[model samples]
Target: MRAVLLTMAALAALGLTGAVAVVALGLYNVSAVAGHLPGVSWVLHTTFRNSVWLRAPSEEEVPELDDAELIALGAGHYATACVPCHGAPGQEASATMQAMVPEPPQIEEAVAHWEANELFWIVENGIKMTGMPGWPAEGRDDEVWAVVAYLVSVQGEVAPELELQTGGSEPEEYCASCHGEVGGQVPRLDLLSAEYLEAQLQAYRSGKRPSGIMAQAVTSVPEERLSELATHFAETADEAGDAPVASAELVVKGEALAREGTRDVPTCLACHGEREDGRRKGPVLDGQRRGFLEVQLTLWRDGVYAYDPLMHAAARDLSNEDIEALAAYFARR
Candidate 1:
């Protein structure tokens, strides 16, 4: 027993000495340009893969990802949030990004190796020591899943080029990329009141709303152009017709919820419904896309929209079913 104890003590002392030596002598290479040794690289990558696999949710846990609308929404977000780092269909990543150690891989090549859930996990909670960042919009799991849906659909295909309206100012051109495009995930701006649209744009620009995508988009636009962009969109007619079919039962449930408030929750109509004085505290939710409504409600519930405490309070008691119903109800209008 004494001999065994002595041997264990000597091994511990040796490990401590090696650790102290590495720190004191600066034996470890910390330079990004130098890159990792082959063995070290192998270990990090293997650990990363296994960690993602283990932590990822099962296929059943993820909502149906085959929806065309969902994939379209994902594509718009990808163009804004991801294109710089990973590149898209025919585009190549920037030269500086290519030089990053453990450089970001093209989505086509990388998605092949990961399952849908694994992709979701990586996108929602970014990998450390790699340049990949998690979704910038807080509590936006729906958006993350949308990106995953896009990845699944785009594996063997190049992304289609979305048309932006031309003959507009540069700021309007930027707005057209997402809002003007038909069948996009974002709400149809044409159906919204100009005042509401302008307010939201101002909120995004001022950081009152927490959307990395919108915040960055508005940065390039002059403050004066915000109203012009809003007017252009508001005057444009909504060509897209009818919300996608949802469960009739779900829609019915949603209608009841929207029309009548429970003991704790207020009627959604009180703020969103028509007012006699022509005042609206909330954006018009009627006829908006279901996915966008769901995401925004979730954001409100999660306290991401700090500007509207009433919205946060209203959304606080909402169950997932309640949210789905509300979105379905408003979407059909």
Candidate 2:
């Protein structure tokens, strides 16, 4: 028995040594340029597919979400959140989006494959290694379920003139607080994409994105504004100086860093520019809000945004200086 144990230990040690050697020698290609080996791809694909199946609740007792209500809420949420990465009819995921290593899959084609519970799980908990972000703030299971219903039912040709589908109007206070014209107009609602606008409101409603003020403010706003607000914003583009404008000095510094990374960082243009259709592994930064950028960076720094390993790795390396500089630069562009 002792002889057998000794042999087993020896084999284990050999395996460990071989594994360490592979790492030490940098045998694994970490480059986005390199394609995943078929076997490696299969393992990852299967694991994701099966893990969703295993984790999702088997019973079909999801809370009652009205089909019409689900579609309405889902539209709002998708407009704000999903459209940035996944896109919608009459909108395309940016050229840069095409280059994501695994790529954010188009939802219409892909979402149908997932069961409602599985979809809920993915939205609530988020898929690891992929860029799919979990609900932003957490603890709103009901809202998460609402989004799941929307995605499952959403399909084919968003009507351009669809009136706000829900029943009531937004509370006067909430509209005035953000968009009363005389209000600081901090949200830049005018320039927002309709799809983008709806998604954000839904996130706030669902507690997917962190916004205490938004939650409190919009919670009382009737569901109709979810669509009305989104549609209104969608129709209006850059109604004022809503686009980000970094200070000249900050812009200079950020532009240099973004277009040409210094000794430590990589250039944004290299991965995101015309050469690659902005489709490389990095997400497209064009036209995204400065406020949103700041929030995401903050999430990255704090280790809360766990949607993708690449983001974690990138954020881990960024210093406060980098974050401020990049935020300022992207905001201006």
Candidate 3:
């Protein structure tokens, strides 16, 4: 028995020594063209599948993936960041992406193999040895969920109609893809001053605002065109802005909160309301969508957006109900 144990220990030490030699001497092929050897592909794929299955978010933690706005937001991100590798419906993966070892699979069919939570896990935390990157911004699972929402739709094989589908590579076209329609999920650009819009674009460009989606989108836009893009959106809000979804009671409650100052919380309109000067820096909230407003307000209040000290102070004490009412009121206005 002792001799058998000794033989086992000797074999283990030999295996360890061989592994170290292989790594130190760089004996293994790392070239993409060479690809993984025989069973190596199976081992890597199995590991990834099990890792995602083990770490995926619970059903309770996963948000509703059927929301239209959520899916649209995801599609916008996919267009800019992912369309290159994952190609949209009827689009084939480019030669460069196909050249990659174990190349990126077209997610439409691939998505059906995984649950939403597993998809969320794979997106939020990228796979090892694969080119897939984790969600660009940290602590923004909401944005990650947007990608999951879109992927879920693709899994169903029904490519969603993207906000009328503005198709182009120009800066204005990209911005209009999500912001073109008034009373849409994103804020109403027409209601905001050019100065405010320009500044926000500059902020997005300079990384003062940390949105993974916006960061990638604005990076492609030329520096000089920031103002041009802002002006275009601000002036061209031809579509009228109105409440696509808001109860009368909710709006009334929101209006009262906006008009009257609570002892601890200032009125919403104190700073956001019309200023004496025709030109101002404060963003106009009058016609912004309730969903968009709620997200921005929550981000400001929770310190997720730490750049604006004043907004942090203003939004500090707002409860979920307060945010909902304020959002409803702004949408109605």
Candidate 4:
């Protein structure tokens, strides 16, 4: 009886091994043209869902809901970073995106499966089998989070200001009309802060940021003009909050968190503004909105906001509580 049982078990093992080898050796068609078999598709989908869930980190901390200014900042970043690939509320992905394999998933359906951390990680590291490329500033987690905050705002009744900035002109001449002209439709020199403008220019110059049209536009400008252009935009004194307002309570709570982080996290001002000799290398976060703030914090925590190394480090340090509080506090401004 024991021998018979052993023999049966051995036969079962051999059968399974042979089946595995057959699949591994490409005995089955694995082409998109063929599509997955019903059972295979189910298995793959289920596995993906479960994997995302299992790998995602959970936190008891909830994001603060009152950040209106931060959300606005996020909008600008989003308009710059994500819109080209994911599209906005009324916009669609670029024609090139449609041709990508496995295509960029619509943000509406895609953001749900990811935790804040997972999102950040994916943005920073990028997905291996997908079209998603890691942010150009591979280490810039702060920017990644900011963009995530913007993504959340894009979902709602976004204000018109969040609209893309445009200049009606021939491709090469378009940016010039606004970027260089005095009293141009856009703000002129001395309107923008040096750091803010410089970063954008560098992103373009280094190919860290993508923009076929803008890339061409910047190439002709002298290095000094590029710096001049950034100063022009940053000095414009644009008040951050253009998005919808959030709650006062949320903003207050967010402020508290930003000013004084919890055990595992550092308060933002420790490096951001309050520091006598400002340790933070990234942008200042005063007068941002809650909606924009929340999305960015979520992204930073998730590891997606990529632009600069300092930004990445700042974001990587954020706990969910800090993210919520920082966003809310900034939003109230």
Q: After superposition, how far is residue 195 of candidate 1 from its true place, in Å?
A: 4.5
Instruction: Please identify model 2 stretches exceeding 4 Å from their true place.
Output: 1-7, 89-93, 155-333
State the lDDT of candidate 3 residue by residue for 187-277, as single tens digits: 7788787878888888877777767787777887788898888889889854634436778888898898778776665566877887677
Tens-digit per-residue lDDT, 230-333, candidate 1: 89999986665345678989989998888877676668998898789976657788778886788788888878776877778888778888998999988886
List candidate 1 segments past 4 Å from native: 1-26, 90-97, 156-158, 162-169, 182-184, 193-195, 205-208, 212-228, 238-242, 245-255, 262-265, 301-307, 317-325
Candidate 1 vs candidate 2, TM-score winner: 1
Off by over 4 Å in 3: 1-20, 161-168, 238-243, 259-265, 276-281
* Evaluation by TM-score, superior candidate among 2 and 4: 2
Clashing pairs in 1: none
Q: How accurate is candidate 4 locally (lDDT)?
A: 0.54
lDDT ranking, best first: 3, 1, 2, 4
Q: Which ten residues in a row have the lowest lDDT in candidate 1?
A: 158-167
State the lDDT of candidate 4 residue by residue for 1-333, as single tens digits.
999999999999999998998888977775655655768656755775666556544533224322543344445545545666676665666777676655676665566555655565555556555656666554444445555554555444453244453544332233433343312012233433587667766776776654332343466466666666665555554432244455777677766666765565555776556355644544566655443355556655565545555445657766776676666576454
**In candidate 4, how many Å is residue 179 off?**
13
The alpha-carbon lDDT assigned to residue 215 of candidate 2 equals: 65
- The per-prediction CA RMSD against the true structure, in angstroms, equals 3.9, 19.4, 3.2, 9.7
Alpha carbon lDDT of each predicted model: 0.78, 0.61, 0.79, 0.54
lDDT of 1 at 141: 73
